[model samples]
Target: MDRRHKPSNILPPGEKLPAATVDIDEKRQTVSATLPNGDTVEVLLYGATVTSWKNGGGKTENVWVSEKAIWDGSKPVRGGIPIVFPNFGPPIKDHATSALPQHGFARNVRWEFLGSEKSESGTSSVKLDFGLYSSALPAKFREAWPLDFGLVYSVTLSEEGLRTIMTVRNEGSSAFEFQFLLHTYLRVNDISQTTINGLGSETYIDKVLNATKHEQTTPSLSITGEVDRAYIGVKQDTTSVLEGGSPRFDVIRDNLSDTVVWNPWIEKAKGMGDFAPQDGYKNMLCVEVGAIDGWQKLEGGDAWEGGQLIKSLL
Candidate 1:
């Protein structure tokens, strides 16, 4: 069984909320970080998954974690930023696929809370780090994927929005390859009314149509049904403004090379146990930033860093 917050966990000295005395709530093993101006960001200890990111002086939320999202440490949280490492999806071959879990095991394990510090952004913000290393893994987990690695992830919460930065370091004697993604789920009033900009004219592999090559014609993408497309080699940064809502998601990627736009419509939602309220599809959109089409080959002792910053326009 997993350990809950104890006296030794050493909680942070966080800002106060409107009525509550404490802003950092670890009651449910979740850390509620607040900016000096009242912006709040909640992260779960299970996956270091940021469940909610609300801007200051506004009730509107940017990050969307499913209402039915699992919190028992049994599986990955349904929404928010599910960090995809080592593997993006299932492997093609039979035997090779059994070695790793879908989207990798990083999201399913407990990350060490490295405490918080005043962010360097010069705003009313705080940044915290969570890390995972092969030395901290259980013996059984190590037997599955023997690569020795370390991952350090940081979340910076500001009145403007939330920014996540990840750095992966190779600790072993041999070179290793890995893929990465910040599987971000943004909340929207209605999916059909949301127009995703920046990748409209790009090239993509449509997973909904069996990975067929496609060239997006328009400058903004509108979703009507089940859609899953992997757009690789994205050249420009994007500010995806969900016009129906004012929370413009300005996704800036550095060293991150791909984008995955997906929405599991009605039918698929019903089939998923993690995503309940079948109609919930209309309220969420996953615009993930990743290096999916290719892998990052890191030599021993080499480290790679990449991240995405989601800032609100409104």
Candidate 2:
């Protein structure tokens, strides 16, 4: 029996229960949802980045945000789940996204709030939709990419987990290639006590080791130092993050074939200006799910979709 589907106590006569609520803060450009059970999720319009998710009656924070994250849209939010689209990492020379900045411009621009609704799944869930079109891009980015595209990002929060889906529509007359990643920063008590279960038999590109290809021999991986590896061709659809030998988060993917595990450790943590408290790396680990090992080509007038569901196992 799924815990989320368990029957609730019957309401007394003439008594009403609180319903889920969604709030939009126009001044801050943020949207937030709160469940009757006290779980909450918040998103920033800038990049449609999810800044916080608190479950367990608002006592536990599953998502992590940098203390120094710029909230005024001066820079990309340093943590939470930032969308990486069009390209991943540094752009390749001669590529269509070559002129775009690292991780593309999706995280640097503001997205329009499409709307919110109660999920049709018969579960107590709230869904928020955001859209970003090529025309909405700044002139500099529009000129750099020069492709007509539309992206619809949907974030749904329920007792099951936080599910995010991105649908890309190529509105132009020609096919275009792009890479996408959901950069999720998950909170943890300690880095040394955390382990990632899955991708044991997959090959990974160790970005910290000059992009060397290596086979993952351990069934469970731990981050000891500055770790940055992209596990390619992941055979499992679900990966679990364990803390102190207990399951903490389960990342379920759809159409996402790769997983990137990263932690800046010491030196790299101190290097980033946005990463505050210097040692904040010990409290956060990035288990990014995406289809970025290679490009996904979308034909004109066609749409492609991919996403991940981050379930809090706590």
Candidate 3:
């Protein structure tokens, strides 16, 4: 074995060591990292999506992915963390993003691998960066929304949890407005036993109810049927997903004001071609964090940043 890989007891005190080992599969267009503590994270260049995250000596998987999800870059991965940019859901007619497809093109295009950096704080952590520029977009997407912008997404993994941050910069002379979201799919043993906390007093827009607005009455929201609600202006930055009264995951957001809780349930789950096993809906929940309730306007030469930290409590 390499000397650096030897047991820590044989090394001198206070000596700096590598935090994690990263592997780049150029043919597959994927990057994976393994920390000394056995925590691991994997990212795909397509959409710069985080496809897998495992903690607790690699025995616990906190992120969810569909078995039938296409990996040929044909479509966005059904699960994991999909980036929503410039638009969310379907685009409004006659709007700036009207010509763009549903949820914009951020999750559809390929991103460049910027690189990876090990934490200098002497902690067992690593950060991977990916970049997407306006010039890198396909002709159809570039023509649909002719705005010069650049996005830098960073995914940091540590022994405690995983953190993802995105920086959006306007490279054009004209100002533009856009919507951004992190569609995070979390894994659970059973959706019926899962409850989301910290959204009790907030008001939300229920897309399933014909876009009706209502206040949340349940302190611990449980998924019984189809749900597609966007809780707006959430005051709490921290939300917890509990499985059978035990906290399974804690999501801490920064600069993200809206939270969308969704579960396709029975029929809707079957409708999605990429969703696997037909019953995959019962094993996952989307606790998406975003700023989709309103547009974020950025002037020329300005930049905006936001992110979230998802910690596994299981």
Candidate with best lDDT: 2
Distance from true position, residue 200, model 3, in Å?
0.7
TM-score winner: 3
Model 3 alpha-carbon drift over 4 Å, by segment: 1-17
Off by over 4 Å in 2: 1-18
Q: Could you tell me the lDDT of residue 138 within candidate 2?
A: 96
State candidate 3's TM-score. 0.94
Task: Give lDDT tens digits, candidate 1, residues 1-314.
Answer: 12121111112345533321124556687777766566777788787888888884547788777789999888899998989887888844443224787887778887888878664333356777889999887676678778889999888776546778888999988998888889999887788788888886789999999889999999888898899999989877664756665546777776677999999999999999889677989888899998988678889998888878787776
Q: Write down the TM-score of every candidate.
A: 0.88, 0.94, 0.94
Over 4 Å off in model 1, which ranges?
A: 1-26, 94-98, 119-121, 245-247
> 76 in model 1: Cα distance from truth in Å?
0.7
- Any residue pairs clashing in model 2, and if so which? none
Reference-based lDDT, residue 42, model 1? 79
Sorted on lDDT, highest at the top, how do the candidates line up? Answer: 2, 3, 1
Model 3: per-residue Cα lDDT over 105-215, one tens digit each = 999989998988875445677889999999989999999999999999989888668888888999999899999999999999999999999999899999999999999
